[model samples]
Target: MGADRGRRGGRPVRVGVYVGCGALLLAGCASMPDSGGLSGVESTPRQDAQVRVFAKSPSKDASPAEIVQGFLEALTSDDPQYETAREYLTSSASQAWDPYRSTTVLAEGPNAEAVHSGTSEGTAEILYRLSGSKVATVDTQHAYAPDSGSYSRTVHLTRQKTTKEWRIDGLPQGVVMGRTDFQRNYKSVNKYYFASNVSSETGGQLETVADPVYVRKQVDPMTQMVRALLKGPTRWLDRVVGSSFPTGTELKKGVKSLSPDDRNMVTVPLNQKADHVGQGQCSKMAAQLLFTFKDLTPTGVDEVELQKSDGSQLCVLTEDQADGIASHGTAHYPDYQYFIDGKQRLVRMPSSGSDKQPEPVPGALGDGDKKLRAAAVSRDESSAAGVSTDGTSLYVGSLVSGGSLGEAVLHSQGKTADDRLTTPSWDGQGDLWVADRDPKNPRLLLLQKGAGSPLVVETPSLDGRIKAVRVAADGVRIALIVEKDGKSSLQIGRIERGTKSGEPPTVSILELRSVAPQLEEVTAMSWAGDSRLVVIGREQGGVQQMRYVQVDGSTPVGTAPSALTGVKEIAASEDERLPLVAHSQEDGIVRLSSGEQWQKVVKDGTAPVYPG
Candidate 1:
């Protein structure tokens, strides 16, 4: 029998009967002999399992409007090939369409309607009204850039006589996904780039900075991200950074794809032209790839192998080896808190555990009766800029003991002290920035370290006044708090270096972008991290609070830690790990508590500051 077949069986038995003594009567008795009944069994058959799969395809009788909607909706799916989405388009359209060209992120579902434009019944048009802000756009080069505003698009459709169904005969080149779908289908990743030069303050270490960009999570993100890195930094960052990839360089033709093998090793084939490059340069290029793809799912690529077009290995780098070739600088903060002490003298609060009392900094500004109101220390901690108590003169001098206090570098233009200069801020380049809020000649000023005169930085015409100005570590961006019509706003402006060279290097404000639009009144703000700011503001008719917001005017998700009440002035380092220090109305100067609450760190201190 076959292995699947069951066995058939039967049972047998014996019987006893009476003798045939009586021949005639025994004939009936012999028939009465006992007998056992017969028994048997049969085999049963097995059934095979059935399975079903669903294919998302265009409907045979879909209308022109439906075809357009279906194509847009299909974009949110995990089908990276977008085969089903192609079903809604004609063969020619399908072949010409390039979904990777760009992505228009809409606020919500698009409103699409069919419009009979021409006399022919085979042709139709669908007008899509895309409401809400266009938060961002990903270009063909895969550079994600922030854009703001609203817009509309029109998608043309056609019908086929044989199928009697509508298809997208003409449409936009790129895909459009709703915000919800965008969040699900795309991920934000940072590509590393080196600063143009080594930091003057830190001996000679390469400064690696992260440039955040978005990529399709399900697509061949490794390839896409590498291509973007090879394209160099975005336009905004071009002037401030450098890349390892040589100019006019790109991956070899016919070698467009990249993927990790079973061992999590990714091989990148470049053009034969790159074969002439040296090993050190090749290692830098490989390091860029390793860092860019470090956060990918299913285990990141552990090692990267770079190859020439001929398939010869140019260089191979493991993650550990890459780390040794590139590194980022640590956050630079002053060792002590510099502020005005109770005696109206420039003093330093011990940041470490060794000191028991506040000590005055060395300098005539700290020893003499100069009566300083505000002070700022340079990133190198070698020099200091101080404002007078009367707010009439701004002085600059050495922080060392017995150092001469220079003549006033800036003077108040206003008659009253209220319109004088606010706190001064120092940029990484050693230039000092301050805003002269003097109503008479209100403007921003930039002073070169040893320059005799200060360069005037133009400010945008506003109904309100410029209260505070803070320069970022990059030295190319500035944050301003403007008060207009009894309301305050947090604004970020790019510092445009003047083309005409002068003693102080002429500078001006090109434009300003709002950061915290929802805040009714902004009290204070400091650069907490790269591309992020810690702001203390109050909502319209609400209490005062502090929160973290992106420099692009987007609020970060999740509620912020407990708000610091009665905060008069706040200061923070570029490092987010550093605790926030603030001068409160009730407790003087304080830092964040272990539980993220505000606790007093010092008494009788004001206008605390840290290096930018």
Candidate 2:
């Protein structure tokens, strides 16, 4: 819903105010419309088809090379213990090998070949060249990090002499699976953790953060996910977030598994050392597991029982009880879409009933001569930011009618109009982010609401020019469309917050990783959900199209919404349930009500945008 006029006038104005050409020179960069949903559009359900997991086993009388090949194939099976795969290895080798230590995800297709290199016939050293693109790596800690390079391994084999069959005597410790198998057998799941010492207005409640990691679908996923939670956040996020499980905490000896009971309850037995933790701390720990396992199955985990090694109960928590202790900032969004109407005025589309006409947002910018090329709304919908039509000036003002349209907050330093600022994005913290594409003085800038000077963010690894930028609703990550060497690609990077004590909180960009590597050119993009993005791009020599991809550079399963023709810009909400809205050259403002087709909702609107 649009911001209520009565409340907007009462809020304090914190951003810097400027005027005319001087203000235009202060705006950072340019970005296309990252607009969201339209009203009265029916939402479509995502496909729920279960992935097929093929089973493979070692051949009884196969040669050493065939046995090795079969073992590698068996690694992709759904067997939790990998019982069938162990048959191809010797007793000692099987005991030493740990399949869960790490998973090396290789490219699609068969790029593995086994060649004998030993002098003797009975005892041979087989070198397997497992060469392919290394897309990602998943460790035992359940952290999914991007990786690239080549890989190879050698396995020692010898005939048993008694059974006259060859067996693997030496092999690597971890498992390696082809891309196709990895996609089918493994799935990504986000584990929730809380910020250290950060409390909400309700008091004693901590804010929850989602850490996405991959786990085996058929393996003991419930246990694996919990263990990952116990291991804590990855290295990159350790400095910023905290966990309920203290250091040195671990599972009790002789307790090798965890599973839900007939009553849909999971009993977690930690070492006796956890007894020192207070009841409040224990409840927080249970809250993390409850949310982590929320989507594990259709029924989901109803409750979690924490106990000591001696079976002494420490604490018990249900889904309802955990909700009271942990807080995920408002997932609910407003009920209307905001965009620039054909008349260059800010307009609102009622996101519910049959009234399809959009009403101008109440403010000076809504009816004035300040022609805007693009605009963005804050997450709270209290303020609005816009760039002039000629891309020379940037303005920040209130959404209410009586509120003042402040002097230009930023102006473009670029020589040409193409070098001006792009569309601006607001995070949950009320900070606005935008990029300056001027080839001479290209830089990323951050504006704090009600603060005077803007902070210039660092982008050390940015080799090319920034075409557009979109920040996630969580305020931790950003999506970028970068052009280098005449080719455009989609990239994602983390927004590291400056933590130096006694200084204002500043921001910097870490190294960026490519997301849609298959697309040669990315024209427009937007955040579709927490970890996924909807991009408008195409492969080399291919026509423009839109598809959904994960921020980790992995292609998700299920068919994407049907492609639209002449689509110039696209927008989507942080909530996935809302329908997607876009501007098409041929059809004007179009909405994707169902995944199969596009429906035109407005015939005259352009540069559509939604509140963050």
Model 2 per-residue lDDT tens digits across residues 1-612: 000001111232111111112223334213423354222111111212232233345547877656655566567656667777788888998999988888887664234456656647655455554445676778767666667777666667777767877888887778876666676677888777775422242355566666778888756678788778888886655655778877877787777789889898999999877877899999999998988887556566899999987889999999888878865533536567777778887777865424577787778667756888788888778888888888878888888877778788888888888898988888766778888888888878889872367788888888798888888765667788999998999998777776578987667778688989889989888887666788999899999989998777776665787878877788887667677888898988777754447777778877777786
* Tens digits of per-residue lDDT for model 1, 350-391: 553233566888987689568888888887778888899878
Q: Model 2 residue 217 lDDT?
A: 75
What are the lDDT figures for the candidates, one per model? Answer: 0.68, 0.72
Using TM-score as the measure, the top candidate is: 2
RMSD for each of the candidates? 18.9, 16.4
Model 2 stretches with alpha carbons more than 4 Å out: 1-59, 109-114, 117-134, 145-151, 195-207, 254-265, 298-302, 308-330, 352-355, 499-504, 594-596
Best by lDDT: 2
